[model samples]
Target: MAFGDASFLSRVRGFLIPIGLALLPCAIAPAFGAAALPEEVTVVAKGSGLFNIELETTVYRPEGPGPFPIVVINHGKAPGNPRFQGRYRPAIAARFFLARGYAVVVPMRQGFSKSSGSYIVGGCNVEGNGREQANDVVAALDWATAQPWADKSRILVVGQSHGGWTTLAFGTRGYPGVKGLVDFAGGLRQENCTSWQQGLISGAGNYGAQTTVPSLWFYGDNDSYWPTPTWKSMFEQYVAGGAKARMVAFGSFASDSHTMFGSPAGAPIWQPQVQAFLQEIGLPYEPQPAFAQYAADPAPVASGFAAIDETDRLPDASPAALEGYRVFLSHQNPRAFAFSAKGGWGSGWGRGDTRARALENCTKKAPEGACQLYAVDDEVVWAVKP
Candidate 1:
């Protein structure tokens, strides 16, 4: 729920420090652990002719030995201006893949961040821009296959926005070891450009013509960048060009559909499609406990109570707790305090079909001890210190 003015509750809340938690002087965690967090790494790739480029990469590895299947995620270009650079972190998507026992590698391509080179794309020629960026994605794939922990025979490329366009471009190359592609709102979109829409269609069709690998493309009906008709036309051209592809168009989401991939709330909407694609392609497709614990089907609401009335931080508030919370919030039938506790405790927020069911759901989430309701909607039912 929209807390609006009362959002300040976040500042006053006390943070729970797990026992043995030690503060680190560094700002971020180091990379590559089964239980440890994803690590930041530098991968040097050979781009074009003999030029070696450095990529800032984040890697999330599942808990295991030997090689794991790899899912390479490509980040999108910022809207309005390509020069408005942002940090690349695909932790949410990485978690999704990690849960499926796949190691996820997200690279900040050349020209972005400290990665070597410049971010040069066709000034107005969107197709040329995509082809250039796809080269970088392929370079990442090349580097991934060479790693000891990555399964060379099974590689998947996925991206959003510009990255999505680049992903389809990578598809056109028919890279041998890479099996599939998933594009979320993929396209190079510049609203003011004279032939922007046609450019995207032409670019997608060109890529589709050469793409041999199967692909899945998704778009929200209310995407701000490329509207429904535009993306639909591009998809038509892509498929008409003989690319084996499937398209799924979802209804409008919380905000602009373009930003869905950036939020945990969007997982329920896209994860299933991805899972089915993996299964169809003969890749491992079991849901991991790590992911299932956080999925909420019907979605949850956080309104009704004062922001202070929320005894524990909601799942959406905590990145560490987002997956479980998203699932917890999406329960089909509503429940009150499906789970809650005072003294800095929280679960997915929901008003269950019945009070008993709410309590049961909460207790089930935390079987370790008694489950209590701190609030139903916005009213405080039980009081506890932060």
Candidate 2:
């Protein structure tokens, strides 16, 4: 079956592929180091507009036991009315840090998916709009640092869109363990507001004046939400107000510049800068040999299958799983095949220009006689062996 259509069976919007291999605890390093798989976790954090609320979070770290440096990933807000806010998954970004041996935390703050509370972004007046969300980030960080596996002394905060704005506000607090901040296409816009852009600049300036942490800001030339010029001005105001920061405007990326950290494809465009920033801030930037080797291997099994549902065949497309798929594709012949074994039978999928090429690749990737093609694109090529 084509992997694209198989995605429709997933309950979540992002990849649902399972990650194979057992991850070691933080204290005991694996003999053959492998990146820790991302785990969906829930943390109880005090909410601002609301009282106590549990934020939905994802954690990714190295498979070992010693405390690891932490990187909190703040998710961007979805477009449209504030009444309906969705969850943000940072699996791809988590891999980038996981490879470097850092614990990455992605939290769905209050009012967002799975997190309790109402979505409220102070209307058009736009003054201090992000402070409320910043509180969530701060609360999440507090909980993350208290975890036994996290290194509270070294923390990095990264966010996008509204989350980006939230990170900037967090920087102003000079939180003890925080080392740096990275903003990806931060800020909100309301065209109808009398002077929304100016209000954003003012907000940035206010935060910048008190921001003690070093920061990196990235924006795309084609960002629709925050135009290049407007964001540049915002950065100017931020820096002018005594914020220590560096800003980079990347070339056009994808359909919208705002999606810089939203997809796996966007990783390459921002990974280098992120790596450099980590090193600049004195955090781990290099990947261990064992983990790198693991990343280079092909993936033939689906991960994160539902424990209660035996027939849940949805594939996980998380960064680690997808990376394995990428490795397999890299070794394949022009029309190479990749097979996933499930339920004592083989389910195969491959990319090629024609049916013959696709089937050929599938068979070639499979053992000499073990693989039997069951589906090609939308067509079934073989009946059940039973």
Q: Name model 1 segments beyond 4 Å from true.
A: 1-36, 48-50, 79-84, 288-304, 307-386
Q: How many clashing residue pairs appear in each of the predictions shown?
A: 24, 17
Q: Tens digits of per-residue lDDT for model 1 on 164-243?
A: 98888777676766767899889877666898999998888987777777788889987878878889999999888867
Name the candidate that leads on lDDT. 1
Write down the lDDT that model 1 would get.
Answer: 0.64
For each candidate, the alpha-carbon lDDT, in order, equals 0.64, 0.61
lDDT of 2: 0.61
**Which is the leading candidate under TM-score?**
1
All candidates' TM-scores?
A: 0.69, 0.67
